[model samples]
Target chain A: EPEVTQTPSHQVTQMGQEVILRCVPISNHLYFYWYRQILGQKVEFLVSFYNNEISEKSEIFDDQFSVERPDGSNFTLKIRSTKLEDSAMYFCANPEGVGYGYTFGSGTRLTVV
Target chain B: AQTVTQSQPEMSVQEAETVTLSCTYDTSESNYYLFWYKQPPSRQMILVIRQEAYKQQNATENRFSVNFQKAAKSFSLKISDSQLGDTAMYFCAFMRPSGTYKYIFGTGTRLKVLA
Candidate 1:
């Protein structure tokens, strides 16, 4: 099974500061997704990326959030201005295409102070 | 839009015993997939089992299996001979077969396997 690696297993940042969460996808996989789980809550879809562009996104993915595959290897989620409520565990996932399961990163736990 | 519902917030079973977690989803699409993902304390999403809507046979993986009732819109996971390592949060998810294939996850059921 292919693995997706997430950086900074844990991060603590001040409210209103910009934060970038990075995910390293498998070299051959083209579709990727970002999801966040607030403490004690269900995991929510943030956005999906395909072929170096945004394919779709949920209402939770506001203008404050942006995703890109800079350099075509590392996929990143950037929060323009983090709020206290933005603290959660963010996971990056890669689907093995149709009829297959998805591989998810261990997750990055973001803590806002 | 598709929605997954995990009615149980928590459950527990003695080691070597059996336990079942409940899940229900709402979707109009005829072709889709349902999945059960295990997230241990480590918080890594591990695929436990998956069921295709078109398949009548229940999906099973070792000690884990699902009773998928398509007409009832219900999918439940049954764990046999549960072990301490089985303690974790179980999430039910729904996904369409095409397009972005984004996952809609339920709130999750925290299971505790006792000694």
Candidate 2:
């Protein structure tokens, strides 16, 4: 099975630093998404991207956050200025298609100190 | 807005036995998709099973199956012949066939398979 790959399984950074998370979605997938799960909490949607543009984003996806397909195969999320509250496991996903379910990456654990 | 609820915070079952996890959702959309995902100690989210609202027949895959009641807004997962590998945090999720492609997930149910 094709898998979504996320780099930097774990990352620790200063509270005010900038961080970039990378993901390589399934080769044939058209839609990509970013979600975060705080410790012991529900997974929350952050944003969705397709056709090299952001399709939609949740309120949690604010000015501090931005996503880019940068290339045909790589999707990246950049947090301009991280806050302590930014500590969480961020997952990149590819639904593959409209009716298919999501295939999530192993996740990048961002630890903002 | 759609919300998925997994009422059971935690559950335990003996190895080789069977167990069921309950899930319910609130959605006004007539057509949508439901899914059950498992997150093991590795914290990797894995897709366990999925069901389409338009299909009255339940969906099953290997040892995992789902009881989907569209009218009641209920979707439950049944694990038969459970194994230690089945111990994980199970989450129920909802998504509509729209442009956003965002998935709304439940708080999660932690299941323990004991020997």
Candidate 3:
């Protein structure tokens, strides 16, 4: 079982501030995903990246949200201007492939003040 | 568009007893997959069980099992001889076999196992 590590286990940022959540990608996996879960709510898919491009994204992924494999090793999700509603647990996931389930990072708890 | 529904917001079961969690989904596609993920207090998503849409037989993992009714579009999880460690938020999810393979998750059922 490979691991997807997320940095800054917990982050606190002021509203309107820019925030970037990082995920260390698995060496051989090409598909990566970002999901968010508000406190006591269901987890929702944000976006999926494949071969260095956005493959699919949900409506929740507005202009404010962007994902990139900036250095080919680290996958990052950037929120241009955070809102109080953006406060949630952001998780990075790597799917082993078809039929195999995903491996999710412990998560980054983003707190917007 | 695919949606997973977990009608039970919370449930409790006594240790060593059996309990079942219900899930229903709406999808037009015939080929897909269903999953049950357990999120503990730590908030790590753990895969509890999976069932392929085409398979008629139920899928099970140790104490966890799924009764997948493809015709009814219903997937239910049954835990036997439940343990205290089973306390967590259980989310039922749906995934397409192709495309981006992104997951559509239900709100979740918070289960508590009492001693």
The candidate that wins on lDDT is 3
Model 3, CA-based lDDT: 0.95
For model 2, which pairs clash? none
Show what share of the native A-B interface contacts model 2 retains: 0.84
User: Could you give candidate 2's per-residue lDDT for residues A43-78 as a string of tens digits?
Assistant: 999998776788899999999999887777898999
lDDT for B23 (candidate 1): 98
Model 3 lDDT tens row, A68-112:
888888999999999999999999999977867899999999999
Rank by lDDT (best first): 3, 1, 2
Candidate 2 is graded, for docking, as: high
Worst 10 residues of 3 chain A by lDDT: A94-103
Which prediction has more favorable TM-score, 1 or 2?
Answer: 1
| lDDT (10s digit) by residue, model 1, range A5-73 | 999899999999999999999778878999999987899999998888889999999999999877879
Ranking by DockQ: 3, 2, 1
Could you give candidate 1's per-residue lDDT for residues B1-115 as a string of tens digits?
Answer: 7889999999999999999999999999998999999999999999999999999999999999999999999999999999999999999999999899889999999999999
Candidate 2 lDDT tens digits, B10-56: 99999999999999999999999999999999999988998899999
Residue B42 error, candidate 2, Å: 0.6
Q: lDDT score, residue A81, model 1?
A: 95
* C-alpha lDDT values of all predictions: 0.93, 0.92, 0.95
TM-score of 1: 0.98
Q: After superposition, how far is residue B111 of candidate 2 from its true place, in Å?
A: 0.4
